[model samples]
Structure formats: structure tokens, C-alpha cells
Target: MSSPPAHPALSCAGLAFAWPDGTPVLDGLNLAVGPGRTGLVGRNGSGKSTLLKLLAGELAPTAGTVRAAGGVGHLPQDAALDTRLRVDEALGVAGTRAALHAIESGDVREEHFAAVGDDWDVEERARATLDRLGLDRIGLDRTTGEVSGGECVLLRLAALLLARPAVLLLDEPTNNLDRHARRRLYAAVDAWPGVLVVASHDRELLERVDRVAELRGGELTWYGGPYSAYEEAVAAEQEAAERTVRAAGSDVRRQRRELAEAQARLAKRRRYGEKQAANKVVPPIVAGGLKRAAQVSAGRHRAVHAERLDRARERLEEAVEAVRDDDAIRVELPHTAVPPGRDVLLLRDLELRHGARIDGEFEVRGPERIALVGRNGSGKSTLLRTIAGEVEPRAGEAAARVPLRFLPQRLDVLDDGLTVVENVARFAPGATPNRVRARLARFLFRGAEADRPAGTLSGGERFRATLAALLLAEPAPQLLMLDEPTNNLDAASVRSLVQALEGYEGALLVAGHDVPFLEAIGITRTLDMDALTSPRGAT
Candidate 1:
């Protein structure tokens, strides 16, 4: 297919901003976004959300300006509707409020009517948009207060789509949504004919965009394709940079060696001159010439040493660049020598319920790396929790071999007020402070970081802290149950976690949507919770 046309819908020219405390966020940043889907990526605290706010006109830049041609619709990170309003009421207010204001201003002319396109019919259009977003089955008169967080997000998305603004900006839109809801959101954006900009850390969502823009070191680098293509290009660049650094280092080393050899020869000649002077057998003129020659040789050695040092410094910088560009932080998990029994886990007629009806039932046996596959609200998490003894089954029963550890999806078991050392010590009481700190270091929480409170740590750090605590326990659990372990981890961290899991000999029950992660960890079996609930032989 031909490349999409670059019809600039949003432009930032020489943008600069800083906080009240004089902390610089964006400096001399420039960006242009065209119509169609574009992905915005950045690490935590990289100003992705700030840029989005600037584009949406929600924040004023300290310098320069942002220009957009038409109305901008922004999906805020936390969008909550009033509990008093029904779904239909919320949509109606969002879609027609602008037109209502214009009419109240007594500016309702033929042009205004034409611009709004029959404001009286906006409710019908709003309903249609909501239906397209899979909200049609829901009652419009239903209060938003009764809906779930995921549902509230969907309703807000539907409201934005119904407005049909010229530009749409979404910031971490899928952070709280389920897999099925996320897929639906992606479909809605794909079908929209307007300009779309999404800021997210979700690789799967980024892969659906037409292009990927990464914010690093206060600058944006645009890649012409999706996440996969961007990753390949970055990897190649890193490899080439590494090669250059290696060559430069080799040259520096050779120069240093030559300098050292010249110094050695000059030293030997100086000693011979001293011996001649001691014997009083050399002429004055010849002695002076020899001294001058030694001085010149020493100067040459000094100059060579300076040059080599400079070159080595430059090469070291190049190596640092290569390392920074490559996300390769490897985390090695300390595996315990625990042998699981033959019956790792057994679930007989495992039935669970959300309301009155049974959601699922199944039988699972030992040595089976079975995946619980189902859409959101299909009771996948419930099944895992039931197996972990966190939830009671409405019917049937579950049995597991001794020693089990459950990593809940929320990571709520971690005490936020305590330091990493304290948390690990709690889990492993006999472990000394030094041992706890050492274990935390393995997970990249080194030095003073190990003393930082868990509440202050980032999402990735919190997850690592939890994992470190689990591993340090005296007798490790043979059956490990993880609920969406990869949700908040970065790409590099996720790879490290997968590597650790691959080496694990214990039975694992993981509930996640990352297909590559599941494959990497060697999931050998598959079970559909939704299928389990259905009548036998329904498939």
C-alpha cells in the first residue's frame, strides 16, 4: 500500500516548558502529527502526558506555541463521570453542549445551524456511536455510578467518538481496561476517519498505529512504521554504534602501548648517560646532546599519553551511547532447589460464579501448563484466585500440593509503607539485613534504593520488590500462581522475567494476555474457562 498522506492536523513549534520549581520538562521540542493513527511512546516521566496536554490546549507552554486546525477531543488518563447522570445524559451533554452555548449566545444563524448539522438530532448520533463501541446492549438510562471502571472508560470513549472532533488524543487509554474492551477501543479508533494520537506503553496497542514516535532525552524521534519496525531499527542502530565504539577503543589501546614502549627506551638511554657521567669518559657537547634528546623523547611520550587518554574518553562515551540505546538490563532470579510433587495441582469440577449462574468448571491435573483463556468478565482471574484459595468456589473443589505462592494482579500483598529491605525481611524472617539488601540488588534495587519505601517506588520497581521477597523465602513455593505479571513491566523487564520463568522447575499458573510471554515461558497446555462453563461438547 502507498504511504498515507501527511495532512498536518497538529503542530508544535519550538515548544518549551518548565514547572514552577524551575524543573525543565520540554525544551525546544518540535513535532508535527498528521491525520491517521500515531503512537506516542516514552518511559515513565518522559513528558508524554505533558505533550498531550499541550496539544489539547489544556496547558500553556512556557515558550513557543501549539496550533491545531479543528476541535480537539482528549481522553484524559482518569476520566470519571458524575454518578448522578445516566449514560445517555452524559453523552447528550458532551455532544451538544457547544451548540447549546452558541444558541444561547444568540449567534444561531444559518451558518451556525449548518456548522452543527441539526443540533436537534445529536442524541440519535450519540446513541449510534455508543452502539458502535459495543455499548448498545447496555441500557442508556442506566446510571454511570452503577458501572465498573472499565465501563466508565468505554462510555467516555464513546462520548469522544460521537463528537467527531477533527483530532483525538488518548493518554494511556487502555491502562485500566480489559483485553476485550481494549480490542474494541482499537477497532473504534481504526474505523474513525479523523486524526488520532495515542500515548501508551502497551506494545500491542502501539503495533496498530501507522507510526511510532518515541520521546527520549526531551526530543521526539519518529519512526515510519509500527512498534515491531521501530524495535528492529533501534536494534540495528545499537549494534552499529557498539561496533564503532569497539574499533575506537582498539585504536586507543594501541596508541597507549606505543607511548609506553617509547618511554621505556628513553628511560634506558637516560641511565646510560648517567653511567657515562659517573665514569667521566664522555665529552660535554655529546653529553648535552644526549640530555636534549632524552628531554624531547619524554615530551613526545607525554603528548602521546594525553592524546590516548582523550581518545579513550571519547570511545567510552560512544560505548555508553550504545548501552543506553539498547534496553538490556538482565535480572537473574535466584531459584530455590525445591522439587514439586507429582500432583502439582488438581481442580475437580472447578466451578465459579459471578452472580447466580456458574461461570466455569473444569478439571486440571499435574505437570500441565494450562492457559486460562477467556474474554474480560469471562472469569479468568476468578479461576486463578479460586485455585490459590483466595476465593471460595460456589461449587466443586480444588487441591494443590503443599507450598503455594500467589502473585495477585493488584500486588496488594506488598506493604507500601516499608522499605524494600523491610518487606523482604518480613517474608523471610531469619534473613539478615545484608542478605535482604543483597537479594534486592539482584532485582536492580541497589544501594540506597533498597531502603526506599515501597510506596515511593515506581510500578516496575514494586513488582521487582515483590518478586525478590517471594524468592528469598526459606522454602520456596512449588506452585506459583501469577495474575497478569507482565501488566506494568517495561519491555526489558518483561524479557528478564520471561527468562527467569523459563528456568523455573515449579508448576506455574499465569493469567495474562501477552501471547509472546506465554510462549517464551513454555506454556504446554490450554484451557478455556468460557468453554468449561458451557455444556460438555459445546465446541
Candidate 2:
């Protein structure tokens, strides 16, 4: 059999990086990747993006070096495109360049040059790539400005695919993409040859990679195989580390007890020696020798105890480091009483629209937990807005028993200029300034942070602020509408939010892709948007 290939296509050696404010983001971090796919997993703010940028040659490391063997391509989490240009035109730039390069190098024969009939061929290729990404039937003549955010994402991917770089870096590629687009992306990734590194939180996508590398505290651990294998290995490692710490603790306790007993025995011997000396019942030399022996024994016991304590401390630190704390942000929604006879929400044949087509028709009742599941652009957001009274349905009547509170995916409900306390005050008008500050504190906003502008808060903080306002309302809204509430939340925050939702008896209509979270919060019913809206044989 032939030996496998050697030499990594990309490598970072002793890489160290820091932010402008002097906070260290990466500390002597080193990683290497050869051909094939590698999945990067880490808690939020773990420097995953910084490392990718370094590898892509977009950012310089403060210390050490990153090296890549071939052309590199990066698909940013949020890509900005020329909205005025059509999709074909945007992608044509790269295709044209490659064609020109080939022509200049005499790689194209006369016959091949003749076959390059018109620019439409290039546009066709671009459109085909987009189609493979589930953007089929979308005209190349359409302006990117008119495209949805999800389409923009697919366009970016199409551009990268056209370029066909030797190494690819994708950051959260599945984010904001609908299920169909996600499946398309997975298919493309599976077929692509060359070095590929993806940083994402999507378990389904990660499971497709050949290896999983977890980033924790500026260190990386690579586990061979898929996500499930990595998960099992991590679980076993944690269990072993915990057992080691426990055993060390027990040893320390045993050593302390033994030391105490030794001290007591030494004290008793010393007292007997001292009494003998006082009574002049023995020679002074013999009594002095007895006293010296007791002191020597006590010193030996002390030394032994110190050694055990030192070992125990080392073991405990090892265990602590082995099980690193996940730093994802979390939000806690406080429980509130629901008013009697409050018809939190009422929907009458509510119809949602996507472009000229009707997406779905549905009705919701008070205090219902409904999960909306569909492919991207299936009118989930439109449905939510119609319910919140933010958007009007073309045809149908919608009403809320009480004022409805909507938390968009972006958490834009709060005014960016207002401080955390001020935002909270807007929802709970009767709340005094002090009371507002207290409420914010319950969600981890305390001290002077309450006065900080909402725009300065992190993604997690913004979500918490929104939840705080909703829960602290004067007549607390019995109906809460959340769109992808768990997208940017940390593990801890997700857990807290789940607990709060479990205790909430009011109606909740959530549109999210987090299956575990949905199951945990007890989604009593689900609305399949695709089934309700599709025309005859549309699927």
C-alpha cells in the first residue's frame, strides 16, 4: 500500500495574538492541518476566528508565524457584497480572471478558445453553483440588494466555489441558513477535495468532518473521527479527571489526620519528658535526648504532610484544567404571574406571504407553546411579525389578548442608544431607576454596567436585556414570541433560559433550529410551514 501524504498544508507555530485593548486572545497557540476536512469547536470568544484569519493571511499574529502551502479562501460569518451588482456579475470577476490567466499561459487551445462562445456561459456556471446551494431558479439578473440575507450567504459561497482555492476556511457557514441550504452546503463540503477547516456550532455539520479539534484556553485537542466519537472521548476524559481529583482530596485529608495524630503523640511524649526532668527522676541528658527525638519525629511528620499537600494541589489543578469552563453567555427569564382572562394571543386564519405566494395559514390560542419548523425563507419570521403586529398579513385577522412582546433573532427590540436600565424602564414603566437597575442585576447586569449603553453590551447581554424587559413589564406579557432565541447563547445561558421557560405557563411561539433546546422546553405542538403552504407537487 502507498504511504499516506505528509506535510500539513497549513501550520501555525507559537502563534500569539492580542486585541487592541491589550487583552490576549491567543497565547502561543499552534495548529496544523493537512489535506481533508477538520472541524473546529470552541466556546464563544475562544479566538477561533482570529486563528482562522491568521491562517488565511488576513491578520498578522502578534508573535510566531502561520504558513499555508496553497491558495486560501475564507467565507466570513457575515459577508458584505456589492448590492448593486447582479449575482452573475459578482461571480464573473473571478471566473474571468481564471479564464484570462489560462489564456495568457497558453493553456487553452484554439478549439477551446472558440468554444468559449459568450459571457452567458460564465453566468450559467455561476447560476449553477448557486442552484447547487439551493438558490436554483433565482435569476442571475436579480440585484443582490433585493436578495434575502440567506441568499447573500449562498452567493458568497458560490463565489468561493468558483475561485476553487486550495484551502478553504468557513466560519459558521450554516448560521442563518435554512435546512435545505444547510443540506446543500454539507453535500458540497463532502465532495470538495483539498484542505478544509470549518468553525461552527452545528452538531450535524461537525459530525460530517473527518476530525474534531476543540479549542479551550488557547489549546487545541484533536480527536480522530466524527463528533459523536469526540463527545464520548471527552466524556470519558472528564470522568477520569474528576476521579483523580477526588482521590487526591481524600489522600490530603488522610495525611492531615495522620499529621494531627503524630503531633498529639509527640506532645504527650514531650510532656512526660518534661515532668521527668522537673522531678529529677532521670538524668538530664536522657531527658534532653527524649525531647530531641520528639521534636525530630514532629518535624518528619510535618515534612510528610507538606509533601502530600503539594501533590494534592498539583492533582487538583490538573483536574481543573482538564475540565475547562465553557464561556458561552446565557440569559435568565424571570418568572411572572399571568393575569386571569388575558387572551395572550388570538389568530384567525393568519396567512403569511413570501414574495407573491402565500406561505401558510394557521391560528394560535392563548398560552400555547408552538414550534415553527420549516426550510429557510419559509415565512417563519413573517409569521412571528404578523403575530407581534409588526407586520400585517395580506389577508386574515390577527389579535392579541394582551400586548405581545417579540424578540427578533437580532434582538433589535431594544433601542441601541438607551442604557440597560433605560431599556428595562421602557418595558416596566412603573419601575423606578433603582428598581430597574435591580432588575437588570438579576440578569447579570450590575453596578455601572446598568448605565452602559445597550449598544455596548455583547450579544448575550443584549438578549438578557430584552428578556428582562419582557418579564418585568407592568402587566407582564402573557405571550412571548422568540425567533432563534438560542442562536448566540452560551451553554450556561441556554440552561438557565430553559429552566425559566419550563416554569413559564404563558403562551410561547418559538422558531429555532436547536432541537435539544426545543425538546427541553416542552414544545407541546409544532407547525410544519412547508406542508401548509406548498402548491401542488411543489416539493
Candidate 3:
């Protein structure tokens, strides 16, 4: 035997949790994570984040127990930092560092010695951790406010690493990170010596994981390999499920045919008996006895065939349950197409209100799909807003010849008080309710889901509704601009977005940091603000 299986680094038994408002999220779920990187994946609101929270002890379970072999460290989705806290304090070594400094200055207090106990090189270790995460330029004395959001995320991860916890849980750690910062985090995940569970939709990051744990429908499932392996496994499972359904369907048909044949035979026998009795070939008493016997036999034969049919139907139902029926977004915008080589937008030496300047002229012709990429605070959103006419340029002129729409990062296009259909109606005022609902169904909001208030939808649902509102607008949007469209979306929503955009024939300008999403959308060119403003030190 292979030396008895090692104990799980993290374990949870009968893990149940419900909100104070009585909405159950995890219902008596159980999971165990061994040492290595495990990417946790699921649809939005499927409790991937919630289970991480529970495992980290950030939220107490409504029932059951969670146990960690050693210490547990968590990096939440928001990664909040105290702006006034210094880097040393953020790294949780300020106290020991101060004590060591005091001792070096010849203060021999017992408390100082106690605080600096065995680890005399805390600052050096902290610096090494920071350097590994690409924060070598940052000074330990500097305040948190001095760093960008992406750097802050790295800083928080650095703190967790410096602690050397046995178990680490990170939730959507790459949400606001740029490509460079993401690579640094990926390196850390690669070198982790203990259990690391990350809940994310980032395919690149997930590919580095040793395994995958999927949380869905209040239950947990373990896949033995990375994201691609999980995808393959699920695909194989679905194929087999479909095959079972086909076989079950065939069995049901065969059973039904057999029942029909049995009934036909019974009818023929009855006709023969009636003819015999009518022709007076047998005694009346004998005919009555034979008729009763035949009736009893027919009832038993029908019951047996019906029971077999019912069993076959039950098998079919089980097979159907095993097959997933996820719907895809299918919106069509034929009117949004632009003629070849037509000028859709023109920017002439414009200086954006947010301090990013386009010194040279920029033109978007026909249906060119351009990606605006840059580090945070480099004015990507400002450029999109200026193009959308939401912000006035500080200098030159920006013009749009075709109808355009802008979907901000906040997804503020919809009215919170209105239903999804009503929100679509806001953009397409001339369309009837039936027509609006018909279009909404393409966005996967069929039937009563179209009646849900915009404010009550989940993150993914809200994004879909906002997209529907913009795409369904009157005159169609030929020049569509989106700011960080995949910021908080789940994997399914991101796939849906790509599918929707694939069918769009309009000129597109999207400003975001998701490289995978940009590639999936088939971007024809990329505009790097850092390169454009390198002479002015914008980077």
C-alpha cells in the first residue's frame, strides 16, 4: 500500500451555511482539499466564493465543522487595505521589526526580547517575499495609498505569503490585475508549498492548478486535474449521458410496441371466442369460463407491459438529469452592420478630460474591433467615455458618425426600478412588449426572468441585462464601447458575451484588462495607452 493516504490540509464535513435572511447557499456540503493548487470553479452565486469564505473562517457555517491542518490565510475579492498603514504593518511584521530595532538601539527590555523571539530576520524575509511578488521597488515604510490597485492586491498576497500559512484561499484575485501583475501572482501559485484553493474564472491561472474543485447546486465535486481536464471530463460525461438517454428512449419505444402487440393479440382472441360462442360450437357455461380466463390473462399481460414501459421511462428521466441543458445567448443585430471602409469614428489630436492625450489622429473605419489596454489609472475608461460623448475632450475634436452606445464598468445602463423588459423598452421605445420579450429570450432571459427587476439580479444576470439594453437599442449601435465588460463576470457569462459579440457586425471598442476575453472577441488591433503616452510619462 502507498503509505496510507495523507491527511487533507483542509477538511470540511457537513458544511452548511445560510444567510441571516434564510436564503440557503450551502446545504450540508462536504469537501476536502489536499496539498497543492486547486482551482475552484462554478457559475456566479454557486457558492465558490462562499465556500472559500467558510473554509477561511471568514463566515461561520450554519452547521458542520471546518478544520485546517495548520493556519489559514485568505485574500478576499475586494482586498481592502488601510491606506494609512505602512508596508511593514500590512505585512504583519511591524511589531517584531520594531522590537528588533529597539534591541539594536541598546534597549534591553524583556518584552522586546519576547516579541523578537526566534525569528530575527523577519524584515529580510518580508522583503524577499515582496520581491518575489514584484514589489521590490516599494519601500516598507511607504503607505498603502502610494500603490495602484493591482499592486495592492500583490501586496496583500505578499502579506499572506510572508505569514507562511498552511492553507491559502484566494477569491477572484486576478479581477483588477493587469497582465504583468497576473504573471507574478501566477508564479507564487506555482511555488506554493501547501494547500492553495483559488476561486476564479481565469482560464490561464486555472490551468496552473494541480486539480479543480467545482461547487454547484449546493454540492461540491472534485476533478482530478486542471481546467482543461475538467472540461474534458464534463464533456465525456455529457456524451455518455446522452447515449444513455438514447438507449432508454429506444427501450421505452420497444416496450410500448410490445404492449400494443399484446393488446392486439388479446383483441383477436376475444373475437375468436365470440365467434365460437356465437356459432354455438361450445356450451354457454364453458364459453363464459373461457371468456373470464381470457379477460384475466389480458389484464395481467397489459399490466406487465405497462410496468416495463414505466421502468424504461424512469431510466430516461435519470439520464436526462445527468445531461446539462445550459442555454446560449443568441442575439442578432443585422441593422448594426457598417459598410466596408466607412468612417465610424474620428479623433483628432484630442486630450481626454482625465489627462490622457491622443497627440495623433485616430480613426475607426467600418467594423474594426479595437482593444484599448493599459495599466489602471492610465485613462482607458476616460477615452471610452469621451468617445461615447459622456465626457468632453480637453483639446481637439472627437466625432462619431454612426450611432453608438457605452456600457460602463458599473453596468449603469438599466433603471433599477424597472424590469428587464422595461429596461430594454427604455432603449427601444417603438418596440412592442412581445417583440421586446422575444429579443430578451435570446439573452437567456426567457419568460418570467424578463420580468425581474434590474436591481434584484445577480452579477452575471445584471451584465446580461445591461448588454441586452444596449444591443436592443433603437437604430442599432454600430460603434459599441464597453469598459471592463468581464470585470465581475463568471466563466459562463464571459462565454456568453463572446458568443453575443461574435454575432455582432458593428464597430467595437472595448477597454478591459482580460486578455483571454480580448482574444476570444477577435480583436483586430490593440491601442496601448502606455506606448502612446510614453513621451509624457503616463505609464
Candidate 4:
């Protein structure tokens, strides 16, 4: 495709990039954006983050040019803020506000006037940005350490918004955010006036984008109007592609049948010609001429049918190529099944070590899916840890009636030196190697991937590996719990996780703020950490 005319916002041309290890992340990618929000989406390791970094000039591309009309503000996935820094300093306005304050006081100086700049409204804008991001309560004088992790993310975004750059890039902006904070981020996205691109697996945030740019196989595909529309379009395209594949297969079969019939007819003709010549019903020369002409005609007939068959086969191949193979795993977890009347878990008067306390009785019976939701500091992970026997509750009892497993968000269960297969085997000692490998394959770990050491796995890969190991554990984990499961996952990984959970008959207690994910995995009920427990929020 030809490049578009110059844009005032952000654009890239003939972009190519590779990692330090010579692993090609992107090649010949071209993109153009002007004054509208774009959601950049892809599976983990598909270079969505790499592309954003390249566009922001944080990483130089191997091949092409990136153009920004003005400055670019980037909020990286792990954009770290100093814990000791004040909110105004984090927002990059402390000096200016200080100078403004100096001028207002008795000690006015020329440097103060210079530092104030022409815009005296900086303080007002900074406060408004914070207010917009639902951080007004945090106070500008407060240190970053005083805020929760989710609030810190919003503060970073607030800083970016305060800068008022011409282009903004957000990578996983909603990673650890709760439902309220996510909505606040969504509002910020909605009100952004400049060119914006967000790389995140958060469906709700992606739903607010004006367009979606999907990076797959080292190329960018533009889909107009948000993630849901893109998904619908892809679904329709896959359906049409499958229909074409079926039609093409039928055509190939029909062409093969016709070619066989033609060859059979030619054989009969040859036999008839030979028999007639032997019987001497006609002159020898005429008989030979008849045979030659019949042979020539038969060769032409065969050629026509053969060509048709070839064309049909080519069409079939093309149709098959068009259809996507988004195959997810399917494995029956019968060993993990809990009978309808079985008691899975029970917690009474739970008081966690971090000053969080849970009152009243809580229980899980049979195979129930429960969603855990709350602000970042809410003790959801602590509750799960107590239930998993990793931590003792300060007050009451947390016990499981069945064999259980807990997969934490940090994913520290695997032994780094062991391969994925080895780790799973360690858990399921009774299972044969072949059975373990077969089950691992269903989790999308196959061949060399299953053989790779757990230490080298990416966040999403490690999550899958840990989940697989836990599921294949001894006694098969009739009760499974996960803390903030969607924090570091990409879209495909999230889908794979959801699908993997679909076949399990075990009781699930998943802690996270991804409402759509909870809904997708068929949650039987929701447990709000704020309502279920009380803790001194993150300092």
C-alpha cells in the first residue's frame, strides 16, 4: 500500500525492528495516525509493546522513520515512580508551582518569573488532571509511597495528561487497576484530545478506542471502531473463509471424479479401437489413423480435466489459508471434579497478618466459580494465601475439604532449573511421562516449549506453566484459586486461560478486577474484598 500524506500527529514508515539477540520482532511495518485514539493489540511477544517503544523513540527501529508533530508522552507498562517523590514533582510541576509561589510571596526574583513561564495556569491544570483521574483525594503534597499500586498507575497517567503532549502511548495502563480505577482511566482516554495509542489486554479500555490496530506476523492491520467491532469483523471473515474452504473442497472432489471418468472413457476407447483393428473390419491405415486421432482427442480431454483439478486444488489451498486456526485447548479434568454435595472450602473469622480482618462464615461447596474484586490494597491475595496454607490467619481458620491448589499472581511456584515438563512431573509424580506431555500439549505447551526451563519463560508463559503444574498436581486439586490472574496476560493468553478453565470441574476462587474475564469463565458469584474484609490500605 502507498503511504499517506504527511500527518500532524504520529506516523511511521517502512518500520523494522529486531531484538538484541537477533530475534526479529517486527518487519516492514507502516502506520499512520492523526488525532484519534487507537488501540494496538496483539498476543504476547507479538511486538505491540516494541512498536510503542519504537514510536516513542525509546527504541530505535532497524529500518524506517517515525515522525511526531510535537512531543510524545509514554506511560510504559512498568513506568516506575520514586516512592519519595511528591505528587506535584511526579507530575513535573513542582518547580513551576514553587516559582509561582515564590513570586506571590515577598521574595520575588527574575529567575522565579522565568521559571513561571508564560502559563501561570499550570497548577490549575495539574490539579484538574489529577481530579479527572480520580486522584484528587490523594493530595498533591502526598508522596508516591502513600498511594496504592493502582493509584500509582493512575498518577503516572495523570502526569502524562498534565504534560499535554501531542501524542500519548499507554502500555497496559489497566494492568493492576481495580474496576473503579479502570473506569477512571477509561474516562481519561475518552477525553484525550491528542493522538493516543494504548497497548493493553483490558477489554473495557479497548472498547473506548476510535480504531484498533492489530499487530500480527510483523504487520499492522487496521480495524475501524474498537475491539468488539474488530472481533466481530474477524469472526465474520473466519466464517466466510470456512464456507469458501468447504466449497473449494467440494470442487476439488468433483474435479477429481470427472478426471477419473474421462480417463476411464479414454481407456475404453483405446480398447475398442485395438479390438476393431484386430477384427479387420476397416483398412489398416484407416484403423491406425482412427487410433491416432482417438489418442490425440483422449490426451486433450485428460489435459482439460487435469487442469480443472489443479485449479480447484489451488483454490482449496487459498481458502484454507484464509481461514484462521484459533484453536484453544480442551481437556477433561475429571480427577479435579468435586461432587455436587462435596464441601470444598470454609473460612471463619479470618484475620490476615496485614491487619485485614474477615468476619462471619464463608464456604465453597461443589464446583463453584467465585470472582474476587476490590481495590489494590484490599487483602484479596492475603485471603487466598491464608486459604492456601502459605500464611496463617491472625484470628480464625481457613481450611479446604478437598485437595486444593493456589496459583499466585507472582508465579513463584516453578523451580527455575526444571523444565516445564519436569515441573509438572514433580507435581504429578504418579503420572507417566507420556501422559504428562500429552496433558501439557493441551495447555498449548508442546515440543521444545514444554522442554524449556521455567526460568526463561515470559510472564504469560510462566502463568500458563504454573497453572498447568498445579492442575496436574497430586490428587488433582478439587479446589483451585488464582490471585490477580489477568495482571500480566495478553489477549490470547487470557483467552487460553479462560478456555482451559472451561473444562475443569473444580471449584474456582479467582482474584482479579477483569469483570469481562470473570463473566467469560462463568462465575457463579462475586466476592468483593472491600465487603468481605477490611485492611489498612496500601501505604
- TM-score of each candidate structure, all chains considered together: 0.73, 0.80, 0.81, 0.80
Question: Which candidate would rank higher by TM-score, 3 or 4?
Answer: 3
- Over 399-424, each residue of candidate 3 has an lDDT whose tens digit, in order, gives 99999989886577788888889999
Please say which candidate is ahead in lDDT: 3 or 4: 3
Model 1: residue 137 alpha-carbon error in angstroms: 3.0
CA lDDT of 33 in candidate 2? 87
Task: Per model, state how many residue pairs clash.
Answer: 0, 3, 0, 0
lDDT of 4 by residue, 325-431 (tens): 64454434545778887898887777876566667677788999988778866778778888998988889888899888898866889998988999999998999
Candidate 4 worst ten-residue window by lDDT = 530-539
| Residue 14, candidate 3: alpha-carbon lDDT | 95
Residue 111 C-alpha lDDT in model 4: 95
Evaluate all candidate structures by whole-model CA lDDT and list the values in order.
0.73, 0.74, 0.83, 0.82
**Candidate 1 residue-wise lDDT, 1-539, digit = tens:** 12334658888889998755455779999888888789888764467877888889987899988988899999866566798988877675543545655776997766556546666666577677767766676676678765545567788888788767999999777754667778888888778798899987787788889888888889888887888888887788778777888877787787778778877887887898888877777887888887888898789777877788787878868676765552433555445334433666666555664521233433334434566555544566676778788888887777776577877665666797887788889999998888888777777777866777766554556678888887777677777788777765667778888888877766778776677888888997766545564434112
Clashing pairs in 1: none
Candidate 2 lDDT over residue span 374-486, tens digit each: 76666677778877878777776667766557888657878988888888898888878887877777777778667767755545567788888877876766678888887
RMSD of each: 6.3, 5.8, 4.7, 4.8
Q: Where is the poorest 10-residue window by lDDT in model 2?
A: 530-539
Where does candidate 4 clash, by residue pair? none
Q: Positional deviation of 119 in candidate 1, in angstroms?
A: 5.2
How does residue 376 of candidate 2 score in lDDT?
68
